[model samples]
Target: MCGIVGAIGSRNIVPVLTEGLKRLEYRGYDSCGVAVLKDGALQRARSTSRVAELQEQVQADGLGANLGIAHTRWATHGAPAVHNAHPHFSHGPGAEAPNTKPGHIALVHNGIIENHEELRAELQALGYLFLSQTDTEVIAHLVDHLYEGDLFAAVKAATLRLTGAYAIAVFCAHEPQRVVGARHGSPLVMGVGGVDAGERFLASDAMALAGVTDQIVYLEEGDVVDLQPGRHWIEQAQAGEGGAVAHVRISEAQRPVRTVTAHSGAVELGPYRHYMQKEIFEQPRAIADTLEGVEAITPTLFGTQAEQVFSQIDRVLILACGTSYYSGSTAKYWLESIAKIPCNVEIASEYRYRDSVPDARTLVVTISQSGETADTIAALKHARSLGMEHTLTICNVATSAMVRECKLAYVTRAGVEIGVASTKAFTTQLAGLFLLTLTLAKLRGHLNAEAEASYLKQLRHLPAALQAVLALEPQVVAWAEAFARKDNALFLGRGLHYPIGLEGALKLKEISYIHAEAYPAGELKHGPLALVTAEMPVVVVAPNDVLLEKLKSNMQEVKARGGELYVCADGDTHIHAEPGIHVIRMPEHYGALSPILHVVPLQLLAYHTACAKGTDVDKPRNLAKSVTVE
Candidate 1:
């Protein structure tokens, strides 16, 4: 995934593009570049550095233009370097000969072009030389080859030959007044600013255009747009009378344009060393915002139609990816036990590729923080195509494609999470998913008045309970010192807390680059016990539950194998410090909602462990905050 931004107006647009690229750096930060159309020519600058460094390069070169496109690239088809960076240029054949100048056309792309190899061979035969080993370079050549005095028509025609997914923004030296953009599978939003003779902008996400404009419109699939100084229009590919591709439908109506307020303040880092640390400490406020107005256990907390949909559905099917999938896996236990509903959790990327029997009465629930994950959206659509109509989403973005596609939604107020490895988003998702579980229980007549009041009171006290857990950071940091010297780690849990074990392992591996794995504590003797040794550190999420005795037996198995133990024990478990064992006591055991509290300490453990190892905690290598591409 990559980030893109464009601006076309009379003002110097370097500051605008630079600020937008800085905001969108969460998408990717391997390399960044910018291209501007000025003085009837194209000027370019690229760097294998952060956006801030790219801005310095632009200023050093003294580049300014009224219209330009910028990109922050995450390389896929080639290594990350200056040659593979974006703003790829294409010059038509015969222009690079003696006494001739090459044509100038620059483009920035976000996704992959599958047919680039075949097209590149064809273009080479036509005397078009290539530069850089990138799939994006082929698109610029194709667009330049098809240009016939109209930039918009050439872009649409070039896209007709493209396969796979992409969201591209192109600028032409021949036509300096326009910027053309198109999206097939990636996300793109157009922003309108000022009034008459004002400015128009485009970005991969609305957050990049926060202060630039409040009026934005999301582009649908196969939609293309051309932005001028004070005007823009959208067009979608449609079919003709004979089932052939016909003329696109161009729409310029202002009524469909939606106004969205930006939360730029939420993304600022306030007294923390990194964004990951700031986000880990933001869990209390984020959870409070997610559970703000819930005073009773009602189905309307999800949406108005949630009650109707819950009544008609017989089973729950959760679809998610990454950490969101682990939250969904934990919810399966809650839905089956408290709501008395059969539930199944599936990985979104693998769900659509397999053959499975679909039941029409099943409710499809999707979980995501950005709400723009490509695989999750595709899996939701695939489930709907199989005649499963009841759909719901627990998402953080209010205007994302998932919210627009689903029938019901519960938007979590987690604000903005910029860390590549999620912290607050995971806990806030559990907050929303727990609310969904309670709503289903009420709709299914499984909750009594007494039980409803008890659960609500417990949920209200979660903020204080989480605060107590955060006080154990010093203990966790002490454990982290021993962990930093180890190369492998094992995590264990049982019953409802098992998924928390999996999440704990994931967090450590994501940021620290350590070899970590998780297994159900009961399943240790089956296969994983063979790998335990004195050098391998074992972490246990030992909450006080009915399975505590069985979990303790497993902990003893690790100790019997001469393995060092690091236990996150509850206050009443009586699992005290002993030889070859270390215990960090939790304040209180949260029953039926223990995953939310248990995960916080694991987050702190991973953060401090990565810190001691001197790794990049915020921008982990080869990981992106938003997985907008498959």
Candidate 2:
């Protein structure tokens, strides 16, 4: 995943481009660069560090222009290096000579170019020298080769030869007043701003355009956009006889401009030390917002056509990745048990490649925090191709591609989650999924009036319940102090809380860099028990449920092996603090909703552990907030 931002404005656009990159840095931060058209040539600055370093480089060099394109890379095709940084330059034909500067075209791209090798060979044969080790360099050269005095036409023609997902923004040194952008699979949004101030912008996410503009146009697949001072137009690629992009025509389809509130205030760390901690603490508000105004359970809560779609489908198929997958796994338990519906959860990346039985009557549900996860989006498209047209998305961003692609959507009001390690987004997704479960159960006549009323009351009390759970952070911090010394951890849970254990393990590994794994308590003897020792720290999600007795036996197994146990147990569980067992009592027992409350302590544990380890809790290492590429 990478971030792309481009601007064509009256004033100096260097600050605008740099500011935009700062907002999108969570999407990528490996390396950053900017290229601006100035003095009838391209002026460029690149850094192997974060966007801040690139901004400093730009300032030191005194580089500024009215039109520019910038990128923060996630390093897919090449290592994180200045040479591999974006704003890649194409020196044009016969530019193999040394000391060629400002050659012709400068481009910033997001997504993989599958046919790059063949295109590189062809371009090199035509005397076009590539200066970098990026597939994006080939695209720059291709555009240079196809330049027929029109940058838009060149980009359109370049896409015809490309065979992969990409969202590209290109600017020609000769055509210094405009920037042309096109997206095939990756995301690109057009910001229509500066009508009075005379500016136009393009970015990978609308959050990047916050404060600068609220008028946003989400670009569709195969849509090519031309942005210039105060004006823009869009064109869609027309498929030829072979289903390849033959030509481009003026877009007749509607791409509405929607007003999205600025998220600049939400991303601020405020009093919290890190975004992860802030988000972890924000779970109460996030869950409340997600369930807000839900006075009753109705299929229309998801969408206007949700009742029709839900009635037609007999089963539920969930596609997601990482933490979202865990949320889906938890929902599978709820959907099957409470809704009386068969549910299957599939890892989005794996599901896209494997062929399986697809039922037309099955409702395909996709879960994502950013809603721009490349693999999940591809999997959704794959499911649609198999004739499962009934699609729904549980996502945070209403403007995300997943929401646009799906027929029905329940947009979780989780706000902007800036941390690379997810917290509030995961909880909000669970809230949304639980609501979906209730809606389906009501439609199936499995939920009576009393049961519905009880569920609704529980849903309304989630905010207060989460607030109580968050107060256990102090106890979790003490556990983190002990856990910070351990190199590995084992987590155990049963039934629905098993997925919570998986999420807990994921969080520890993701931010704290601890090698952690989770298994059902019963499965410990099957294999994971062999790893337990005096130094091993086993964390258990021991809620006071039917499985509590079975989980206690598993704790005894760990204790017999001299393993230290860190347990997050319910208040009434009677699992007290023993010599080797440290129990952090939960404030209350929240039946089917216990997983939601149980996860907070794990999040706090991960946050404090990562803080103790002195790791980057907000950004983490080798990970981005959104997975925009496969």
Best by TM-score: 2
**For candidate 1, lDDT tens digit of each residue in 1-630?**
599999898888988888899898866579989999889988888998888888888999998998999998988888998878888888678656343443667899988898999999988888776767999999999998899999989998888888978999998999989999999878898888843346888888888888888888889888888888878888786777887664476666632678998655237677887888888888888988999999998888878988888889999999999999999999999999999999999999999999988999999999999999989999999999999999999999999989988999999998888888999999999999998888888888898899999999988988888888988889999988888888999999998898999999999998888889999999999999999999999999999999999999999999999999999999999999998899989989889988999998899989999999999998889988889888
Question: What is the total number of backbone clashes in candidate 1?
Answer: 0
Cα-based RMSD of the predictions, in order? 1.9, 1.4
Cα displacement (angstroms), candidate 2, residue 263, comes to 0.8
lDDT of 1 at 24: 86
Which ranges in model 1 have alpha carbons more than 4 Å from their true place?
95-102, 194-197, 250-255
TM-score of 1: 0.97
**Top lDDT: which candidate number?**
2
Provide the lowest-lDDT 10-residue window in model 1.
95-104
TM-score of each: 0.97, 0.98
